[model samples]
Target: MAENQGFIGSIVETVKTVFWALVIAGIFRTLFFQPFWIPSGSMKDTLLIGDFLFVNKMAYGYSYASCPAIRIERIGIDLGPDDFCGWFEDRDGRLFGSEPERGDIVVFRHPVTGRDFIKRLIGLPGDRIQMKDGLLHINDTPVEIEDAGIFAEVMAPQGPLGLRPQCANGAVGEGATCEKEKAIETLPNGVSHSILNIGRRSADNTGVFTVPADQFFFVGDNRDNSTDSRFPQAAGGVGFVDRKDLVGRADRVMFSSAGRSMLAFWTWRSDRYFKALE
Candidate 1:
């Protein structure tokens, strides 16, 4: 009987320990940081499809409750930007936090779809933004762009020929094609980073967009492939992201793998492990 009692006690203790550990972990995630997986090639070489990174919540102070979900029970008077569905008028406000600087990569809740999105901040509130012939223009001054040579891989080709991934060594690989234009773009604030241009697309040339107060303009480094503030929400773009929608800033890549499944250890990209995000 004593032995059985000891075994039961051990099980209970293990359960209690796990429960408390999870609780502590959840608290830490909610307040300090959160892990995010890169599932798309939108960020491209800057951030790969399998990269896992942590967003610093303390960077912009903590939101009321981390903007838990898309739908929130309206607890107070409705705020403006009425087009956003399931938006929290009261709980949407951010707590103590600094404003996002230009060239910083930000993660936020998409106003129209309520889905989370990560993109680079290009235009701040009241900044004029436009794209002309595949180049970024801010406040009517053109940003500098320097060609960085070719990056040999075109992912998710629009045509039906499937993939034709190119390697730097003139070798062809399956499920990949290397035929992209890479360039280094310098923001007005002197923050320089790499951008990929996969030929001119519809968003390459757009009219002037004057960002409104308490809002921001964001674009992806993958200029032609991204659907960002360059397009309006009505047209399946993010439109102007509200300040209240800001989540946190991504700082670094904790780990990365090449394939869809992390369990595929052979596909692990050791070089990308603990890689710092520029």
Candidate 2:
């Protein structure tokens, strides 16, 4: 009888440990940092598909959008930020709110879709943003861009989505070298980052976009590939994102995998571990 009682006691202890661990993890995720996985190459070279990082939630303070969106398709569980913090919605501003700097890489919720998107903050409120001849223009002045040679990668399936990259050298078979024109673009704030180009498209030229108050403009580093603020939301683009939808800033890449599954140890990119983002 004593042995059976001890076994039961062990089970109780295990359950208690797990319960406390989960409670701590939930609080940590909610109040501090939120883990984000890179599922696209829109910010290629700077942030790649399969890159994992934690968003600094405290950077811009808290808002209704700061609440986590838990979606586990396998278990049929789907919850959005609105479900968690909807009571906080339609508020004027964030609690302990801080303004985001220009040229910072930001993750924000889509104003219309509530989907999360990561991009470089380009235009602030009331800033004029435009693209001309495949160059970024801010306030009627073109940003400085210098050639940085070609960014090449294998023309194979990337990440879990199996999405192949678009190449500047036209279509190529799998295992072939895919290339894009790389350039170092300097934002008006003097923040410089690498930008990739896959030839010119409709996004390369646009009429002046006058950002409204409390709204900001964002663009992808992979210029031609990203559907960012340059396009209208009705037309399938992010349009102008509101300040209240800002989630957090991604400061570093915790891990990165080139394969479809992050558990595939051989496919891990060791160099990207704990790499600081610019």
Best by TM-score: 2
Which residue pairs in candidate 1 collide?
A: 152-178, 153-177, 153-178, 154-177, 164-177, 165-176, 165-177, 166-177, 166-178
**Candidate 1 C-alpha lDDT tens digits along 1-278:** 99999999999999999999988986777677877877666777798777888888777775543533323446754332223323444565577777788988888878877667899999998999999998999999999999999766544432122223323344445446666788999998899989888765789899999999989999998786677999999989999988877778998898887665788788687998888777
Per-residue lDDT of model 2, residues 65-160, tens digit only? 888888888999888798899998799788884789998889999988888899999999999999999999999999999999999999999999
Q: Report model 1's TM-score to 2 decimal places.
A: 0.82
**Who wins the lDDT comparison?**
2
Q: What is the lDDT of residue 80 in candidate 1?
A: 24
Write down the TM-score of every candidate: 0.82, 0.95
Candidate 1 Cα errors over 4 Å, as ranges: 1-11, 64-93, 154-176
For model 2, name the residue pairs that clash.
none
- Each model's number of backbone clashes? 9, 0
Estimate every model's Cα lDDT from 0 to 1. Answer: 0.77, 0.92
